[model samples]
Target: MFAAAAIAIIITMVLALIRGFIGPTLYDRILAVNMFGTQTVLVIAILGFMMGRPDFLDIALVYALINFVGVIALLKYFKYGSLSIGPGEERNTEKSSHMDKS
Candidate 1:
């Protein structure tokens, strides 16, 4: 039933939170956080169905888009010092500069 599915999603979210907290590396934590966000979307959808509210799906879609964008931003932040681009050739130069700085 939908209730059972919702319970399973909650359990998965809890596990994801634990992994995010105790992850050995930054990437591991990022992945766990992303998983948690995905699980949350599922929970929202399930709750929407249970409550007979169609708006929950709309909220879930917005959350999913936000989650996707957030993860991409985080990954870019980790890889590049800044989100601003420095042109085509400068992009490579910037990467090399970043590496040299590290």
Candidate 2:
């Protein structure tokens, strides 16, 4: 059963990779990459269970947290043009000022 689940996850990951490569927009590619990361987390957990190694769960948890943060950071950068508050806010303000001047 574990093997079956792992196979399914691998298949999903392959599909996600394809989507990421051929996505029509930047957001679509990001979404596909995020899905692939999520599937990797699941695979790690499943493998840990299958091998009776509880420590793998901890690694999987860490990976999940990192993956979430990475995806959020990517999206924030795409939308706001920076990950830091100061730079992002400054950019937005500059755009507003330019509009005001016009």
Candidate 3:
């Protein structure tokens, strides 16, 4: 059963890579990459169990965290064109004088 699951995950990972390569929109590709990362974590865990090596789970956990941060950074970079800006910082380059009066 575990073998079957690992095979399924590998298949899905391949599909995700295809999507990441040919997705119509940028967001679609990003989402595909994120999905691929998540599937990788699952596959790692499964492989660790099958091999009776628990250390792989720790590596998987770290990879999962890095994947999460990477996706968020990608989104931020695409949205704001930079990652140096803080969350509450204004993204616009120009401030309107009319709005400043209020």
For TM-score, the strongest prediction is: 3
Local accuracy of candidate 3 as per-residue lDDT tens digits, 1-102:
889999999999999999999999999899999999999999999999899997899999999999999999999999778898767566556576336645
Candidate 1 — which residues are off by over 4 angstroms?
Answer: 86-102
TM-score ranking of the models: 3, 2, 1
The digit string of per-residue lDDT tens for model 1 on 18-84 reads: 9999999999899998998899899889999999996899999899999999998888777665577
**Residue-wise C-alpha lDDT for candidate 2, range 7-77, written one tens digit per residue:** 99999999999999999999989999899889989999999999999689899989999999999899888
RMSD of each: 4.9, 3.8, 3.1
User: What local lDDT score does residue 71 receive in model 3, on the 0 to 100 scale?
Assistant: 98
Which residue ranges in model 2 land beyond 4 Å of their true spot?
Answer: 86-102
Using lDDT, rank the candidates from best to worst: 3, 2, 1
- What range of 10 consecutive residues in model 1 has the weakest lDDT sum? 85-94
2 against 3, candidate with superior lDDT: 3
Q: What are the Cα lDDT values of the candidates? A: 0.86, 0.88, 0.90
